[model samples]
Target chain A: MSELDIGILALQGDVAENFMSTMAAMNELGIDGSVSQVKTPDQISAVDGLIIPGGESTMIGQLSMVNGAMNALKEKIGSGMPVLGICAGMILLAKNSKDRVVGSTKQPLLDVLDVEIERNSFGRQKDSFEAEVSLDAMDIPSFQGVFIRAPAVLRTGSGVETLGKFNEKIIAVKQGNILATSFHPELTRDVSLHKQFVKMVADSKS
Target chain B: MIPLSGDLPKSKGIKSESVDSINVTKGTSTLKRGFAHMLKNGVVMDVTTVEQAQIAEEAGAVSVMVLDKLPSDVRKAGGVARTASIRIIQDIMDSVTIPVMAKCRIGHVYEAKVLAEANVDMVDESEVLTPADENHHIWKWDFTTPFVNGARSLAEALRRIEEGAAMIRTKGEPGTGNVAEAVLHIKKVNDELRTIKSIYDSGDKQGLVSIAREFKVSLDLVEETAKIGRMPVVNFAAGGIATPADAAYLMSLGCDGIFVGSGIFKAEDAMERARAVVLATTFWEDADAVKEAQKMINEKQSILGLDVNNLELRMQDRGGSA
Candidate 1:
């Protein structure tokens, strides 16, 4: 694949770190891609792919709405533009997110992915854990998964394929050109996930 | 030079010295009054960006934690420690006059030192979402800067305090979005200490030893630790703090303050949430404030799936050869 133009959502969350990891991933794959921060709707149009970093789901949703990027993101996802959502990003892409714990605050989801997410299903911070799972579709075996206040894929539409699972919970999933993971693959040194995402973008472009 | 006397002649220079001394005395008194004033009324706000920092100040938060990320880094490799950059820290500091704090890895003294130079008032040694530091505890005495270390149990909390920590925080675990763990931890510590004091009056060494063994620690050690500072030293409650009620819950547990990372900025109404948290901590006894705080928590965004076991520190070379 030729050099790909990748953009990371910079409205909130781990914007800079995601950009660095994405660039590192591209370098590992020998793919010369230019990664930049995309906050405006216009910037979305210039990128071949986008990575929504992990953060507080509600804030990202509210900020995106306030900044006028919510609608643009929905439109982009609708157009089958390749996008990767990690952790909070995964919650935002889900059709609906159910907070397992009792609380009153609600998040405005993008509803791009046809899935239901159970927020903080793995318990609190002390209960946070990790596992290795195989993404058979991507031919990646046993990648280390990080789950911080991560959401779980409770249910998925027929179009979505479960890519990886840990402790019988779905952690990675993909639908058409859109991909979402409950764990943060970018947080790790492993770049295979990013490579897979970049390939998806390349395939979509073709 | 003329010899100095107890009572010098009323020369212009001498008179000027007397005036300067009086002014210094007045200045010290004024500073003490100001600190007391802040303790009575100062508020703390949770913020992320520089814009949010400015808004926090306007909303009456006494201090702000310069967090670009929330408590969910447990599942990832490059945790929140590596996530929050220097530029972001500088930006938030530039935007506000109130004390700005940032999260750092537990043993990453280098990061803490850098933050100290940046002039952050305090560093929250929190393990909320970031990867845990290697086993060696932070040597607080090594740094001239002050820090607030997170402790889950009384023993751990007291140890951090013993290490000369400027402040203490109950580690309820980050990203849980629940305050029950924090509540339980604080209650257990306070209750245990009470029990120890009553037993000490009876001169029951065997009873004390048994109790300490049951707790899997030493009572004398804990007492020694407490002696490093005054009892109930600057303790704050953190982790899973999502609403004003949560902040109030911590205060009720005898915490001096609360640290709300994602609760405010992540809420639908950031400004209102910030104000509510401040109110909750201040008027903790007011049922109305508690109700208001409970209503401010975000139910939908509370789900966090951070995996702590997989977050073991992997030594990766950033630029140099391993």
Candidate 2:
């Protein structure tokens, strides 16, 4: 059994927290894995799995492109690398994004997932809040969801599964090896979502 | 690619998470306090426009302070510096997801109210702005929004805290790009803290009382400040910090975080300088990292800094007791 290698996109966002929580999840699961911040294309290619933490999606997308991580991430994910993108990270993973306040945005996006996301669907920064969300499909009885300028999944491809919804709008989705959520799970104490991602990574390896 | 689980999560009783809108007079203090706490070990840059705010967010600034002009520009223009335009503030708010802070003229309560109405994350009762009142500072405790006040000594810091400042920063000479004033201010406050700490350790009640009287603050706040051995709130180093080494040096000096104004955008290589500053701030302890950060931008590209000694008006000398 090889130690699972995890990489976090560190161009910007909650990189450190995600790295810490992923390690914590692995430790709690009695799993041996190494997690490190990945900033370049070569680093991203070496990881068994990747997690893009919540941050400004436009900034992250631009920075990732500048560092050549965008093309690398797209190629790797296309080849079967499991990934978990939170908040702005999820926005980057979407195929399209619409800004409700501005009507449209020209910000850079990855456009991988077959989902159309509405940016700032939750509300502004002051409107950010926390609440319990159900993810019973992953055996998560109730997961604490922290939403800060979070996006909403307006529509998804037939291949995608909606894992959680807030306000009757899809906030979490999975397609193939990709798992994305509009809310930040890393901000909470529960690592059940991360544990599920780790399990998905291990199963992919076998 | 491995196929994801097809089973959808049961949407049985999950209702839309109700959002509690933040109000000015209700539960904002805790929220603002926690927000300041979240900025620990981070950097906050002064940004003038939405594009600059976007750049600051990309450079990993914990938050941005929006102003009408950079401090250096205000100094050069030699005019009354006031809060940024509400339209600019709104554009900045929409540009980034991170917190946005706006400055108010010293002792201007109405300016603070205007900023709160604009929905800024924080208000800086800044001395960089020409003092609107010569005698007193804003009664910050009256507002639910947190305020960051500038101080040059232990007395100034205590006085501001007494008036309900959520955060304290050194009143270094703004716009000069000289780190000396900031250093001196931080040192003065820190030295006084050490004296009070010794007094507390020796169980000298009279000493504590005298110190409180001299600083013109409550004995309880003074004693608690000594017991904590630092400012009761987050203390950031500001004024004229212009380089990676300058930022790293202040972090080494024990400030909680940093506030950079003219240092970044004023530079010829703003983008590289911004990234270098963030890198140096995060890796201040590592000499090699700081060295690399310094090399990111050429020395000639650095701003031509003004000497603090020749300044006609000292921004730090505005408002409040000596």
Candidate 3:
């Protein structure tokens, strides 16, 4: 496999966690690659894959929108650059989203994915939990999921593939090159989900 | 035994995954600690009203800490400052999409319980408010909601952590608008962390134990911190951080993030200062970006700072013994 450059969107939230996990996954998989925190459009464009770590969806989208990286991200993801959006990242990738408590928000979004998201479906930090979620597509039996002010997919378009669910709520989905999850994959010791994304990036480069 | 070659405590100490024990469990140490990770490298602003909360969110704060009044106002009132009104906290919660937080007095477990019931994203057991218990802080592990506590030294920080505080902030002189105390507190923590790391690296088990006793924390916690060379949990600079450069300076000192108490709302240009702090914090390593953010409030400075030495009440001293 050729050397790959993977970027963790660094505008806010868990960028370092994702970078460390992805690098660990690459090392475990024996993939020659590099992972770094990326903030600007050029940094986003240079990577073979990108992971938008879990954070405040409104803040991430608003900041990214103001700085022009949101448009660049849409363009790249539209053209099949492999990307993973976790929690807030999932909120950004969806076409529509509404808070479970507050109803609707005017926050910026990347409307590339055809789905609707329910923000904080499990409730606030007090309601955050650890759950065992099984994603058949990732080829892992079950993974420990950390949900913190997590978002759940309320609707999925025909193109979207349901990857996993917890409590009858959709938590993971993939459509073409875009993959998203409402749980943080970087927070756990398990690297299976990251390995899957790295595999996608490697395949794209090949 | 100190596992010198073992995995760093970054992922250690946190309970390993057990399907039967952890599945669907709220308030697990893992979940509480991971919640703090989400706010790293982001600014959390203190807001009194819905408008200020909205301004904070629009300014790109990762979260807003709802207080009954700004610290400066609380200082002037010269009365017991308690938890914020539930109505105001709920109202702010409704107005913004970001996480909403509020402060409760130290060892005020019932106040914390009320905050948890109110569904505030996080509760701060803060010194800014009058201490409810002079002898002890709340044992935070009992609650499902996470708590952030303030510390002026490594011993204080470790003691709080021992009692289940998931996050730690410097107990700078709140309402003073002075950054001196905050800087001193964080630097003190850093220096002690370095000392512990060097001792552990030297394989001095006796020294480690003595240091642990000195810190009033477990040897295991000290060893874990020594291995990681930083706080076991995310440590942020808080209290009296009035300027964007203050925020940037704290970030450069290796703090995870910042919390602005009276800084934004009491400033000459509250909105612009809020925006600037967020910008400076997010791009702390970029000189050009910090310069641009600093230029926003060109002539308007932050709140005129009160010299911390002149303050009658040293909030940092509250609830220190326990």
Candidate 4:
């Protein structure tokens, strides 16, 4: 596969860690991918894949809209660009969000994944936790999942395939070239999820 | 055969090493210690810019809570609030290794993700600030990064802990600048724990059932006790922490740390106040430090009048209400 350039959405939250983790995952997978930080709308065009790290979805969406990166993201994702949304990033990708306890947040959402998310269904920060999730489709037994104020995929559309679950709630889902997880895979030492996304990126490019 | 010191009453179930050792001395008191030096007695600085973070660090703060504005701003300027920028977060991370934390609106997993991506030592799901999603809680099973959450009750704290939050903090509603609510919540949790322990000690199934029944009614208390059982995980006090004494008082209540947002910067002597807060965290029981801290109080400047409170985005969920 040709060298793939990966960019982490750097507007807010977990950009650096995601960049480092993606790079590490690419290196581990023997994929020659250049990882960089993407802050502007134009930068989205330069990368083969985008990893929207975990962050406050509303802030990210609002900022991305104010900064004009939201449209760019939608356009890129529309063009079949492989993207991975972790935690808040997944909320941003969902078609709609439910249970947004703060207020009516009408930020730009990618709407790439035909799913509805219940933001903070896990109660409060004190209720945040970790567990082993079984993603049977990936042929993996279980993966260590880290959830910090995470969102759940309340309802997924027909195109989306459920990838993983914990406590009976869908935690990970993938639709075509888009992958979204309610947990932070990059936070852990585990790079398999990143590797899987990289593989998807590679497969899509091919 | 065993020495009296070895046989001295230790916290039930907690490993001898895990129980906090409190030693009282005439002039100096033995500083309380916890697992992994989790900053049990730490100072929280509400900082927006990297410069303030530096000042806080240099001033002896154990940790800093990076925000886009001081609490005063949120009260005056009503709008969507932003957290510290990536540049500032990186700058602060670069400046100090003493666990820098940032707040994300409630259920704003993306913010947590961003903080995690930034490699922030920890993130706080701040209830004092507005939430991104008004309805849902930030699901704890999502990210690998450790986070802290604010709780008003023991059940809330325990639920958060079960959700995989690395730490729990008492949610003393922010912007109020009053610590009364937090104090009450802490006391309630403690009092309920004692009651539950007594019932559990009776060693009867009926006693267990009664305790469980009580737990259902006071879910937060049960959760808090369960969280306490999970050693090494921190339960700090946050919101409305105003002075060195306040920080020290929280420590005295058995909080692992204190998250002070507007307390330091809002005061006239920002540096001096921050330094005093840091001192309080380490030497909370020391008379000299207390005396020194008392002198550092700034009566002229109050965080309430500042516009720090108006800066955050307060989105409410459609289904669930806090």
Candidate 5:
């Protein structure tokens, strides 16, 4: 396969870390793909795969909408471009955000995934935790999940497949080329999830 | 007589394919620490408007602090410098993807509570504003949102930490755009830490206890800080940092990060200067990188910095002096 280009939505939240982790994953996979930050539509359109990193969901959604990146992202995801959404990114990609305390938050959402998410499902900012997520389906032994004001999958559509969970709560979900995880995989030393996502990107490119 | 490693506290239920229950803490302090770690070597810019926040984000700021008035302007206005308007804070929060931090008057728990309710990434019990309480600071431990406070000495930093400040920044003379006071403050804290370290190294437990009594913080926290030889929480340099060189100097002095206020937006070329400051901060050790960042800005375009001595009010003097 030709070199795959991976782009991290640079609108906000751990963009540099995601880029670094993706590069590490590409190197581990022995793929010659380059990882760069993408904030413009032109940059988004050029990537073989994309990542929306964990950050403030409200800010990311509002910024993307104002700059037209959200529309561009929706089109790319619709065209089957592989993407990974972590934490706030996960909340943004979901069809609706159901805050455990506020019910449905009115923040801007991409509505790309047919899943209901509970924002800050674990608790407040002080309630965040690090846990080992079971990703048996991905053939990984165990991925250390970093949850920080992270969201959880309250419900998944029939087409969506659950890939991982933490404390009996859904933390990762997938629908075709789109993948969303509540925990921040990039924050950790482990790049296996990034490798898995890169593999998906490589497969799609072929 | 000792138990096996598997018998360690909460390690018995090691479950696969699930969040390790053992890693959960009573509070999300670990997660907050992780967040602060990610911000190392980054710049947190103070911005007033949504447009300013956008520019900060585009310029690669790790976070943008929302304030109604610049420190200089607050000093000049001479009124109660409270937190930014909630609507403005919300707008800025919505405008940028980076973390948005807002300041509350020292010891104003209600103001901090309102900010937390607004869902800011962090709250700063800042001395730059008029103190709501003369003798005490807000009990940060009561809040779920992590807090950052300013300090001039190790005692101040540890007190804030004991009260649960997730981060610390030197309380330089705000609005001056002069880095001298910040330098002095950070140096004082550093010198105190070095002194404590020597006491610990010499196995002078009595001396350590005396130091703890002087600081008025717990012995355990003091010992932990002494062992680590630094603030337990992330420490960023703030107050009067105007230029990229100023930022680089502070970072080189061992600050984890920097906070630029009135320095960027107050300049003639906000965008270029903001970007340059971020660059210099991220690459403080590299002289070439700092020089490149310096070249990005024209000195004439920089904010006219005020002399620290001439400032009528010293923010560092606010709150508990000890």
Candidate 6:
């Protein structure tokens, strides 16, 4: 059996952090896997799983749209590829999103996740902070949620299962194979989230 | 491709997967340093107006650094280079969805305050701006807003970090339209970091302590930096990067990102040059792709390269005192 290949959407933003964290998670899980940054649809297609790491959503969306990776990403996620979208990635994966300050945006979105997001819901860089989040079902006790100009889930469709919330705001959720977080799990030592996503990919491969 | 999941917008109650409410801790080290991490591997363009800010956003800049004038213009229009007007920074913030950063003259507390109160995503204690105080840099711990400072060498970089800078960029001679200085700065930092990493690997604490004393920083700073084998914060290549190749070369040198000062809007083909630089920075390892990006811009439209040798006032030398 071939080792699972997971691609981090390299359009823009913290691709290296995701690459390192995901690699560590794969190793910790005792799973043979490789992680690479994918900026093109062809690269996206080659990966068994995907992670759209946090960065500027507008930049990521614009690059993804112009490079034709947006549609490719949607196609892959729709096909039930296990995926983890973090922070700005959460904003891109939503069905609809508007900024807390600038109001609505017209940038291209993957729009596969059944949620409406509000950008900078926690405020600007000054308001960015960390939290001790607990993922009840995943047994991720005391997971540090690093929210940096992060979004908040305003609404989740009936199919969406909320995995975590902070200050009454929906911050992490899952709908089948699609997992999204409003905080940066890759920014810290906790690779449990990545490990869980990798396990999902490993299970799907089997 | 369309979304494959249920289009049913039924708002169901959460499945109680959330364990319990969490405590929010603001302005911690992770929050400060992690903010800049999001900008890694991207281009941050400097813009003076809302239009330029929009152009930067459209050109795929990770963020727009709001400046009162391009570094080139700042040089030509010399005098006291102060922080940009609050109104302009607010306007650029309103015009673009990307995070907005602005420069405060090094050691200018009030200017930094105004930029912070204006709610910019980050502040750059910039060398391009005339130093408000040559003897002192801002003690960044006073502000919750993250700050990026320019450094020409590893000691400067570590000093700024010790002073609470969340990110660092090479103090490439701004406005010169020459990347030579930026190249040299990053190379120096890389070489020093390598030295420290090896010194730490050899289990030489005394060497590290002396290194910290030389940097005028804390021993912990040097130890942690040596352990990490890189800048404690995201270090970008900044100032004078006026072309796609310039941006790519800096990225290849291991700078976390690219910051183009007068590189974009000063050119005849600002938008094309901006996009080309973004492409090159994002795919620096791909020589073929970088070549294709270079083809997007005409050399004739490029910013006139300035000979650093002829420049009398080097912006990089400012604010290095104390």
What DockQ number belongs to candidate 3? 0.57
Candidate 1 lDDT over B204-272, as tens digits, reads 777767765655545764443333332334456766676777777777776666777655665667777
| Candidate-wise lDDT, in order | 0.63, 0.80, 0.88, 0.65, 0.81, 0.86
Q: Candidate 2's residue-wise lDDT over B1-322, tens digit each?
A: 1011111123121123333432112223333343454465567899998888878877767789999999999998987898889999999887776678999998898999999778787799998998889888987766656679999998899898777677889989899889999999999988998999999999999999999999998898888888868877778899999999999999898887789999998998988888788777766887987899899978898879988888888999897563
Pairwise lDDT winner, candidates 4 and 6: 6
Sort all candidates by TM-score, best to worst. 3, 6, 2, 5, 4, 1
Candidate 4 regions exceeding 4 Å error are A1-206, B1-37, B204-232, B302-322
Candidate 6 lDDT over B122-200, as tens digits, reads 9999988888888999888777788899999999998887777888999999988899999999999999999999999
For model 3, how does the per-residue alpha-carbon lDDT over A1-206 read when each residue is reduced to its tens digit?
A: 55899999998887778988899999999998899888999888898899999888888887897678998999999899999999999999999999998899888899988899999998888778788889998797799888899999999999999999888899999999999999998888889999999999999999
TM-scores of all candidate predictions against the true structure:
0.47, 0.72, 0.95, 0.50, 0.68, 0.93
Task: Itemize residue pairs with steric clashes in candidate 5.
Answer: A126-B28, A132-B18, A132-B19, A132-B20, A134-B17, A134-B18
Given candidate 6, what's the lDDT at residue B149? 94
Off by over 4 Å in 2: B1-45, B49-64, B77-80, B91-99, B131-172, B180-237, B243-259, B265-301, B309-322
DockQ of 6: 0.47
| Runs of candidate 6 exceeding 4 Å displacement | B1-22
Best by DockQ: 3
Best by lDDT: 3
Which regions in candidate 1 have their CA more than 4 angstroms from the true location?
A: A1-206, B1-43, B73-80, B129-133, B203-221, B224-231, B292-322
TM-score winner: 3
Q: Could you give candidate 5's per-residue lDDT for residues A56-125 as a string of tens digits?
A: 6765675576558889999999999999998878898999887665465457888989999988688655
What's candidate 4's DockQ score? 0.01
Query: After superposition, which runs of candidate 5 have C-alpha atoms over 4 Å from their true positions?
Result: A1-132, A137-144, A149-163, A166-206, B1-27
Better of 1 and 4 by lDDT: 4
Model 2 DockQ class:
incorrect
Which of 1 and 6 is ahead in lDDT?
6
In model 6, which residue pairs have backbone atoms overlapping below 3 Å? Answer: none
Better candidate by DockQ, 4 or 5: 5
Query: What lDDT score goes with residue B306 in model 6?
Result: 88
DockQ of 5: 0.14
